[model samples]
Structure formats: structure tokens, C-alpha cells
Target: MKLTLQILTLTSILLPLSYPIEFNYPSVFNFGDSNSDTGELIAGMGDHLDPPYGMIYFKTPSGRFCDGRLLVDLLMDAMDLPFLNAYLDSLGLPNFRKGCNFAAAASKILPATASDLSPFSFGIQVSQFLRFKVRALDLLAKGRKYEKYLPLQDYFEKGLYMFDIGQNDLAGAFYSKTLDQVLASIPKILEEFETGLKRLYDQGARNFWVHNTGPLGCLAQNVAKFGTDPLKLDELGCVSAHNQAARFFNLQLHALCKKLQSSFAGSNVTYVDIFSIKSNLIANYSRYGFEQPITACCGVGGPPLNYDSRIACGQTKVLDGSSVTATACNDSTEYVNWDGIHYTEAANQYVSSQILTGKYSDPPFADKMPFLLPIKF
Candidate 1:
């Protein structure tokens, strides 16, 4: 009952805070899925992408798969922090930057779930975060003007750690070589997440913007590509099983957060209800000026689809380049989703506005989200 009340109270508070507010987040260290990927995965994993992805931002794929700036880039600009650098981009310890996102294109909450994901698993992502931190410290000890390069601690004692994932865990798995043994692997995957959280807490990571999963079954990709029917389904479509799995993971995630807060004493945990925010975004895309809410903007098939689903980014595929296997929608900004599985930059902006403005951080996933409400506080 207490939990329910707390969630309700938080939700009420967020509803009003939806409008823009003045808030500054210094040095955001992102983790989790592709929602905040930026370009880390494409840069590190040879299996990831390169040029065509970033054409939106830098006229070439700086590893980003967008036609313009990403949510992180906007946040960085809002906070006055330099854009997040890919850890792999540094090439050496001396080039370390305070903000190097470790988010992969297909990262998951748990290691077990991520094993099937490409190079950027949760464990690997955490490691990369640590590695960058270690390297940052090395630069600090070297008496370099690290603060000038990546400033944040002076304004905010609580650094931002954005963790978003769980979507790919199910999607990638279903698409990958069959996983007849997946359902049994849930517990272990949850454990991996717990383990990583402990490590992060020990390393002085307090502020977290951990996102829950969104509606998976509703994605255009899942419906159009995975459905047996030939005439692909529209935005108002999805898979019940996949969405159920996402809900299950989120439940475990919240329980884990509660357990971690108690087990590892003296830690502040804020869990943001990204699942609800995203689901609502899709459900109410029309309210947000989105003409199409289910499909992607780069592919060909139809709503909730992508340019090409079979091949990983940057990797060429063998399909008849003309097949309607998948497609991209037009006017990404008009849609709540960029790809079936990911939200567009505009969507990210609105969600960020809601959370950062003290709108929903106290209820669910925002429970783990830092009180980024005050630009000064």
C-alpha cells in the first residue's frame, strides 16, 4: 500500500511538471540501451556502425544513427557539458573525458540477457564506464586541467548516471539464433544487474536515471516483421508475449532496486518509470504532434519498421535490396518513435523535460532518477 501511494503521489507531481523548467545536469554518464546510445556501440564494436549513422549530427555517422542531434547532445547543451565522447574514440588514457557513454545499441539489464547482444553487454558497459573513470582519474592525477575539459562536480555533487535498457534483451534474443532456453535464464539476468549496481555504488555513483522497459509488442518492427500476416500491421499494433517479458523484467528491476538500497546501505536509488512514459508517448503520439507513432523513419516497409532489420548497423546484408522486409517512415519528428524499438530525439526531449522538471522521478523509474529538478539545487 505504501509503495502504491508513493507511486501515485509521484505520478501526480510529475503530471504538472511536464512543462519546461530551468535545470542543469553536469556530466551525464549514460548507461543502458540504445535510447541514449549516442555512438558508443558503433565506435567500439566492429559489428556496429560508422558514417551513415551520424549524418544527422555531423554530416557523417559519428556513430549515431540519426539525421540530427540526439537527446544526450541536447541535454549536454542544456547543462553546458561537452558532448559525450565515445570511450573508444579516445584511443588512450590521456584522452579520457568525464562523460563517455557506455550504452550499446542492444544492451540489456542483465549480463545473461546481454550475452546474446553484441559487444555492449551490461557488464561490458559497466566495465567501460569504470575504465573511463579510471582513465579520467589518471588524467586528474597527471595534473591535467581535467575540470576544464569535463566540468560538473563543482555545480552538482550528484553526477548523473542515466541507465536505460531491457528492450533489446527480448528483441535481439528472438531475432538471434534460437533461444529455446531463454525463459529459464531470467533469474540469472536479474542477478547480473544487481552485481553491476553494487559495483557502481562502490565507485561513488549515486544519481541514477534508470529507465524501465517500454511497450515492446507495439513496436512497428515487432508487429510488421514478426507477424505472420503479409499486409504489415500499423502503429496501433504489437506482441503480447514480448511486452509481458518487458513488464516482468521491470518488476524484477524495481524489486532489485529496493533490495539493493537495503542491502548496500547509504545509497539513494531513483527508479524512473520510463516504461510508462514511453508507452504513453506511443499511446498519445497524436498529442505530441506525431503523425505516425509506430514505425521508423529510415526504413521502407511500413509503420513500426526499419530500413533493414536483418543486418546490424554498418554491416551489409545479402537480401534483395528491394524486398519490403522492413522500411523507414518519413518525418521522424512527427512520430514518437524513431525506430520501432527506439524513441525519436523529440520524444527524448519531451521525456527529459518531464523527468528533469520533477514531474515523474519520484514515482517509478524516476525513483532512481536524480532530483535534477533544480538547476542549482
Candidate 2:
């Protein structure tokens, strides 16, 4: 009996050890907007440096807009990869051996204006990647001591290329164009995205993970800005027109992903349905222990939204001849929206959990992905 028990214990340990590896992506090259900006925006524009931004995890502003890690950070943890350093980060020589992030806050597929915080468009980011590739390869060829900090040539072909932009492209249009006009503009925006993707493919990227835009109407900023008219509100108190636009954009984006998969031979292009996952989270916030679903945890004004365009998070601005500072809530964990526009770290963590489940992805992650680290609240 003792010999049999020892054999069973040994088998159990070996069985887990022999589990087959599935998605063994060597590196992840991320391209997106504010949703995945680790510190690129701060590096580029020198903004978002304030208290309450990285309070939960970093204990100080770490250039990320959230109180803790973003969706990209959580995904990296699950993949057993180090958090991606921003490509533009000039601070203390950033290591790029694993991967690099080209995402920037306020960036979009289309070109940005001079006044824009991140003038780096999707094309610009692609160009930056091209530049980085050349420079890093040169350093490695020279046998520089810092070559260890750069990615090998094969990593580009084997790495997973991730994208999570386009929300801002849709949101910005609402300010200047009618709903129909905004809907009409999606094809052009996606076409630009296609051009960038093709450029990357030419440079030899194979695995792709693309996230569609979320429910724009449900955002605290939009609810505060466009939800004044009761007729515009949907069943969930979100702007009906904005959500409609978002869904249309997502549908087109999904179709584009399908087209790209067929177009790029041997490329595994996976489109993740971020809209449904985020919508479900907002609709069922209470179930997930979130109280303020459509309210900003760190913004001005009160009640339904607590967001003010005049004053940013952690900024003191004069309103009605009096100064008011946009401070954080007592507990950020109970809120979904962080600074009217961005999501809280707690909310990002929840979204990451749902994504890893694979149900929200088109063609589903399923058994293909193995978690290296479990998500924590």
C-alpha cells in the first residue's frame, strides 16, 4: 500500500510537469491607444503625472493612467512575460529583448493634430517600430554589451502582435460629425489600420491578437457629456447612438480581421470581442462587486457621473470662481471608471480575467492559452 501511494504521488507531479505548451509566443509587440499605454504618452507628452493614477500598485504615478496595471500588463503577467517597456521611454535605458509597446494615449488610426497629446498615429507608431528594429539589430550585430537588452531577429516573426486602438477614432468623431457621418467614416479609419497591419506583416509578424472597441456610450465621460437628453439614453442609461456607432464599428472591424486572416498566409489573426465583455461588465457591475459603474472615481461634479471636462483627474481648476480639485474616491476597487475616460485598475483586472476565459474571443482562446500566473484583485 505504501509503494502504491508513492507511485501515485510521483505520477501526479510528473503529469502536471508534462502538460503540453500551447501558445508559446516568445515576445508581444503591442500597438494601441490609451487602453494599453504603459508610459508612452507620458514619455511623449509629459502629462498624467499626479497622485491617484498609480496609487493601487505602483504607489505613485507610473505614467499609466490607471491606479494600477492596465490590460496589457495583466496579459503579460499571464503569459509569464515582463511588462512591456514603452518604445519612446528615454528614461533609464528600456530593455526590449522580450518586446516593446508602441501604444500612446490619445493616439488613433488617423493622423492627429499638432495640439494632440500623442501626435503618433498608427502609421507613425509603425514607422517607429521600423526604426527600432533597424537600430536594435545594428546594436546586436556590433556585439554591444547591451545587445542582451534587444530582441533577436526571429522574435519578430514568432512574437504575438497585439492591437487595442480605434475607440478614440469613434469617440472624437461624435464631437464634429452626426451619427451617420461618424458611421460612414469607419471604413476609412479601418483602411488605415489595414495599411499598418500589412506593413507589420511585411516585416514578418505572424501571431496577432486584436481587441475591438468597447461600449463607448457606457463611459462616464460620455454619460456626463451626451446623456443629458433622456431620449438619447438606452435601457442601461448609456447613450444609444454612441453604442450603436460602436457596434457598427466593431462589426466592420471583425469583418476586417476575417479578411486579414485569409489575406495573410500562415498568420493566425484572432479578433477579441472586447465590446461584449466590457458591456457585460457594465451591465452586471454589482455582480462583480463594482458599485459606481458609470461614475468616475477621480473627477469633479457629483452623482450620476462625477466627471468634468474642465478639470482633469488630480488637477485643481477654478470653476464658478472657486478652485476644486478632482480627487480620488475613498475606495477605487468599488468603481469601474477611474478618471471619467479611463478604467480603474480593478476594472482592468476584471476585464483581463474575462478575456483569459476565452469565451469573449472570436475563435476562442480555449485550450490554446495556458496561464503562467493567475490574476489577482
Candidate 3:
């Protein structure tokens, strides 16, 4: 009875009120890489369709990289909106009235080649959004029959334009470029980002929520691959050079947000400091009820960081004449890393909780989410 009452109380308090003070973004148009991808990669490329990927929430692989809901999913729920369907997915003739997701696994700010994991670069995503908007308007122009299936013309302007990319850009650069070379590429990357944002603004996108890249060095993949040299690792066992690159990239991104805010009037551009939130979570994992901060829950190998690039989660291979399957941890809630590259659902939930507090956002939401204060997982 006590547990039931607690659950009820939490749910009631967490429910978003229809108050006049909150931001009412009717829909959301999201862009980025795997961190926010709903199912564009799997929907377009037919990959990662396996068990243990979406076991916790959807009871099956739902095209998301995480085991369950992502930060984007939680944010949409908070705003009383349905999850965005991948723009490339057309299996059920999915509804696009709320919005659409253009993010894909391995996507980046710059363009991607055929050899890349995802061909939907930031520019390509913007192009898709443009095509989507045109097609949606055409559908509505036909008559009222299409109103339930697609967004209205004005929904494009009223909706929130969210970005959660750039991680892959910096992370991928480290594979071939030196630390200084990687840092030098930051300007060009942000230049491409700025170009994309401007293109969206030209198309009537006003409200923007941009998330800066997080600590890349702390990811199990990077740590396992780059932390071979003790001298290269930081006090937290993360790769120092990778983290340094991320910090520099974030600094540039924040400045770009500030610039965009000034360049475009009547625009509400909010720069979210996701790097600080993630770094703090990893640094204080125990306080947040997490056990393995830098280790991947669904991966091969074991110990400090259970990750092996050779085998991904839910994949099986014969090694030394024996089958080896990289499986998920018994309890995913205890770990922060999901599959070396992404965050677990629990960690994503915690990040979402912190984001709701309005503390991590620049020009903060004026403490609009006070109801989140008493809630705890």
C-alpha cells in the first residue's frame, strides 16, 4: 500500500499541467544522430533489428538504440506529445501530425558517404524535413480528410526544432586525426551546423532547443579503445584527449547558439549544457543510484568497461570455436552506458529529469518545471 501510494503521488506530481506559463510547443521536429534517433537507421537501412534493444519499454526492438525511451522521448512526453516517427518509416503509414524524427545512428553534422553507417547527415535531415513539410502541406491542401494524418502548414513554425547531434563528428575524427587536428576541425563542423540552423530558420522554424555534445571520453567504446595508455586516461579512467576535444567542441557550439540568438530576432534559441549534466552524472553515479558509470551494460568483455567493438549487443559470433553472444546486464538500471556508444534508459531518464529542472538550459525556462523537484527514481 505504501509503495502504491508513493507511485500514485509521483505520477500525479509529474503530470504536466495545462498552465498558461509553460512553453506550448504543439509539436517537435528533431534532428541528430543515434542519441535521439527513433528508428531512422533501422527503418532506412534494415539494421539493428534484434532483441534486448527495446526489451524494457516496447518489449521488442523499436528502432531506438537504447533499451527504452531516449531523452527525446521523455521530453516529448513532458510536452504532452506523441513520440515522433522516423521520417523514413512508412510501414503503417505513420501519422506525422505531431512531428517527425530525422535523426539516425552514425549521423553527423557534415555530410556522410555511402560507406558511412548513416547517410542522413544534418543537411540531409534538413532536406528531408523540407520535403516532409511540402508533402504534408500538399496532403492538407487536398481536404479535411488528411488533417488527422499530417501536420498543418503553420505547425512547422509553432513546433520546437530540437537538435542533439555533433557527438559522432568529434568521436569519428579521433580515429584518424591528431588531437590538434580534431580540435581544428571544430570550426568547420559548427559552420555546417550554423548553415543548417539558418536553413531551418528560413523555413519558419522559430523555437530551437540545442543540446551540446557530452563527454565522449567517458563512453565505454572510447575508454576501451583509447585508454590503453595510462598517461592518456584521466582520473575518472576516461580518455583525456577525447574529453578535451569534446569540451572544446561544446565551447564552440555554445558560442554558435549565442550567435544565432542574436542573428535572428523573434527566435527563442536555448542552448542546453548536456556535457555538464552527463559529466556530473558519471562523476556522481553512486549518488544517482548507478553502479557502473563508464561501463556498458549490453556488451561483450567484462570488468572496468565491458565493451568490444568486434561484437555489438545481441550479436553472436564464433570465437576460438565457441559462440560468444554479447548480452544485456541482468539489471540495466544500474548502468549508465547502454552499448558503449549510447546512454542507458535509466541514465537518459535521469538526464531528462535534470533537463526538466531548467537548470541546464541557458536563459532557463524560468523554473517552469518545479513539479519535478520531489520526484525521484
Best by lDDT: 3
Q: Cα deviation in Å at residue 102, candidate 2?
A: 0.6
Model 3 worst lDDT run, 10 consecutive residues: 1-10
Residue clash pairs of candidate 3: none
The number of the candidate with the highest TM-score is 3
Q: How far in Å is the alpha carbon of 239 misplaced in model 3?
A: 0.8
Residue-wise C-alpha lDDT for candidate 3, range 272-323, written one tens digit per residue? 9999999999999887778889999998888878888988888998866789
TM-score of each: 0.75, 0.92, 0.95
Cα RMSDs, all models: 7.8, 6.5, 2.6
Worst 10 residues of 2 by lDDT: 1-10
Residue 203 C-alpha lDDT in model 1: 83
Q: Which stretches of candidate 2 lie over 4 Å from their true place?
A: 1-19, 372-377
Number of clashing residue pairs in every model? Answer: 37, 0, 0
Give the distance in Å from residue 96's predicted Cα in candidate 3 to where it truly belongs: 0.8
